[model samples]
Every structure is written in structure tokens, then in C-alpha cells.
Target: MNISTIGIIGAGNLGTKIGLQAAISGYQVNMYDVNDKILARSLKSMEKLLVHLTRTQQLTGDEGKQSLERIFFTEYLNLALQDVDLISESVIEDLEIKTKVWQEIGEIAPAHTIFTTNTSYLLPSQFAEISGRPEKFCAFHFHDVFYSKVVDIMPHPGTSSEVITILEKLGRKLKQVPILVKKEHSGYIFNTLLIAWIDAAGRLVTGEIAEVEAIDKSWMINFGMTAGPFGILDNVGLDTAWHITSTKRNPASRAFAALLKSYLDQGKLGVKSGEGFYTYPKPSYKDPDFLK
Candidate 1:
């Protein structure tokens, strides 16, 4: 499985992050979104990522620009899928929409093209049939490609061993530490741990056990972590968080979901919208003494 060319469906935060990361890894990336506006935003976000990477010396100025040069943004799905060896989708987490997209990809993409979803909660098996090649479908869940370096890959039962081997290599090529899970699990590895931790943080706030700032501060000071759960929420995007919380059954979780929805309604979608649980580009969490 030679996968030098990658197609990323969905130009949202995760999609854009994946593309920029792919570019940095020297792969030709095709970023596709149905909405042109979303595609434009993704392109701008890629430029900003390149600027940051260059500023941090992760990439040279020329390297950053060249990385950007390799990304091809398109509203036309067919063009983006052209000759793509692997397609990773980072669309909304809804099962229905994802299945539909996979069905479409099954029809449009080449027969040998491998299909992977960047879904955190849903399992690949749920939509493997629609993918046209269950043997080639798997979950390649990435955790904030910029900061977190891990990508957990869970292949469905029907997925081929060859696909798993190729994806592991691809993950390394993208400069990620890939963890292979033999069985399909909802949320795989880090996120399985993360969802519980975040839920507890949200419950604490809802129960008035601590204020949002206080909760994050406590975690940062106690653990020497760079960012706490609220800070994590900002990075995860309020919309995405809200969608994840929608799966909860308890009252506290519902309250947290509603709170996230309120923020979403106001367009304060964290890093993507520039305001979420905290402000972005210069959130207070970035301060050296924020933990204090």
C-alpha cells in the first residue's frame, strides 16, 4: 500500500489540522468540503498553522510555504478523490451522515483506495458496509494532530491485516505515534480515557463543586498539565463536544450538553469560532501563571 497522496473529507477543525499535519509530513493533501466557505476557512487555518509551525521552528519558512503549496482545496468531491490512495473523513460525528458519506465514497473513490474515518465515538463497523470495502475500512482517530501526537487505529473485524499494516506506516509517515487496537471499540485509547475525564469535569461544574476556571486551575496546578478539561474543550470545539455529550443519559451530562449548545448557538465554538470555554489565539490558559 503506497499512500503518498491523501484525501481528507471535511474542512472543519480536525480536517484542517489533519491536512496541515499531512502537508508537514510531505504528502500531497487534498482537502475537500461540500461548502466552499468551509473550504476557504480551512485554507486560511492551514496558513495560520504553517505560520505557527514556522515560528516555532518546527518547519523552515520555505518548508511552511511549501507545505501549504501541497494542499489542494476543492468543493468538487470527484476531483479531490482523483488518484487518492487513502481517504480519511473528519466530518460531523453523526452516524447517519457518515454512513451516507461512506456510501458516496464507496461509489466515487477507486476500488483499491483505503477508507478511514476520523470519528472518535463511532466504530468503523457501523458504516463498514457503506464504505464499499469493509475489508479496507478502519478508524484512524487523531487527537489534536498539532499538540497530541497519538493516533489510535481500530480496524473493524472485516478489515484486512494488510490495511492495518499500511495504516500504521501511514501514521508514522504523518509523524504520529500510532497505536494499533485489534478490536473495534467506541472512542479507542486516549479518547476513551478522555471522555470520562471530561465528563467528570463537566459534572463538577454542573454540580457547582467548582467553577470552570477553578476546575481547570486545580487540574493544572495538581498535575502540571499544560491545559485542563475546559482548555481541552476549547481545542475540541464546542460543537464537537456538544455532539459527544448528546450521548449521555444523566441529568448532569444533559446540563453540560445544554451549556455547550448555548455556546454553540452564540457562535462561540472555541478555537474555530475564536471563543468557546475560553478565548482563542490568546486564551488565558496560555499564560505562564494561569495554573496559579
Candidate 2:
């Protein structure tokens, strides 16, 4: 199905990026979150980003303004899901919460509407077992920067070819490159490979192979600024990196878990709580403070 009005369940970074990009692409976007405050904050953040894009010549004056007007933010789930042609779930990473939300979404959304999850670990089929529309469900993983033009489209055993085809088309419309995964699996393609590197990095950090600065600088020198792992982790939030790496550790997540515990104990959680592997000068999205 051609997705015109898209509903996004979470208004976090990924959700906000997708929603903003969808809006810019001339698709009506409705973003929903449990907290009204977050929804309001997300709207403000979207406007700020659009303004920045306009200044950078990345977006035309009319396009930026139109994109801002295309997004509808709300805390009401039913209203957001109603009449939406496609819904992308970007809520918390927990399966139980996702299942609960999808079950509710299944009951509200039209049967023909496509349901997609932005989960990195959970497969689309698992949600189908509990959610309402299995055949129409699939995985649409967006990178940290949705506008980067790269997306992973994963279809499970229950997903129909029709759904996959439609999602690929939708990805193109949003200016994203769609890479399909034939089967469902934890971490799909990108994250699985990324997690391996992340695991090795965590070990290096804990084992004192190199300080965080050296590890981060090495990647910057090789892959350029945005490609560094430690820098990326700092921007993504240490808590999030910890959550992703929690599944792998020297002692089955023990080493990483202990590191996370100690970091939290010291009250450093990266950009969010102010300090992490490195301290932040301000809460802005500048590169992670390398030395503190």
C-alpha cells in the first residue's frame, strides 16, 4: 500500500528523524508518545532541525516550512493510528512493551494498513504472534540518521511479499536506500555486524587497551568524524550503548554490566546526564567531549 499518512508510535531520536523526513517528503506524519511533554519537546526539536536545514541550504525555504506544517504531534494513541496508511513502532526496546503496544495497535489500525517495527533485536514474526496483523507486518530499521538514505527492510516468515514491496517503495520515497533481509533474526544484518565491533571495543575499553580518547581518535582519523565508534556511542548515549552491548561481555555481559554499573554509580551517562566516557561542555549535540 502507498503510505501517505504515517503514524509513528515513539517520538525519540529515531522516530523524530523519520517523522521529520516523512514530513519533508510530502507525507503527512502523526507522531505519538506516552508523555505529552515529550511530544511537545519533539515538535520543538523538529522545528529547530528544519530551521537548521534551511540555513544549510539542505532544505528550501518552502520545503522546510511545509515539512514543519506536515507533522502532527499527539499523546493519544488511537487518534494517531486512526486513518494512518502505515505505522512505524519506535517505542522502548523491551519486547513486553512492544507486544502490548502492537496488540493495541492491531485492534485500532485498519486491517489493510501496514505495520512495521523499528526494533533492532526483536524479529517481526515475534510481534506477529501477539499483534493483530501478521501478514502486513515487517521490520523497517532506520539508521541513527534517517535522512542518511540507508534503511534495512527485514521480512519474517509471516510477512508477505506485498508488504516488502510496499516498504521498499516507501523507503525510496523517503530518500532512503532499502536493503532487504530474507529472514528474521536478532540484530538483523547491520546491528549484528555492528555489535561485534562494539563488543570488541567494550573489551578494549575495560581492558585498558587504549583510553577512550585514543579509541575514538583512531576511528576519526580512519573513517572521518562521524564514523568513530566511541564518538558515535557518546552521541547515542552511553546508556543506550550499554543496553545494546549488555548481551555480550567477557563473562556473558558481566564485564560490560559492571562497567555500566560503575559509570552510573559515578553519575556519568553521556549527553543525557551530562557526562559519560567523556564530559560534555554543554547539553548541545556537539562532538562528545574527548578529554575532561
Q: Which window of ten consecutive residues has the lowest lDDT sum in model 1?
A: 283-292
Give the clashing pairs for model 2. Answer: 270-275
**lDDT (C-alpha) at residue 61 in model 2:** 84
TM-score, prediction 1: 0.83
RMSD of 1: 3.1
lDDT of candidate 1 at residue 76, scale 0 to 100? 92
lDDT of 2 by residue, 1-292 (tens): 4678999999987899889989998999999999898988888888888888888888998998888788888888988987899999999889899999999999888777899999978889889867777888999989865446678899889888988999999988888989998888788887777767766777788886876667766766676565356656666677777776666536735686678768877888776777876667542223455322
Q: Indicate the residue-level lDDT of 261 in model 2.
A: 66
Flag regions of model 1 displaced more than 4 Å.
208-214, 234-240, 255-292
How far out, in Å, is residue 257 in model 1? 4.1
Off by over 4 Å in 2: 208-210, 214-228, 249-252, 281-292
Full-model lDDT, candidate 1: 0.89
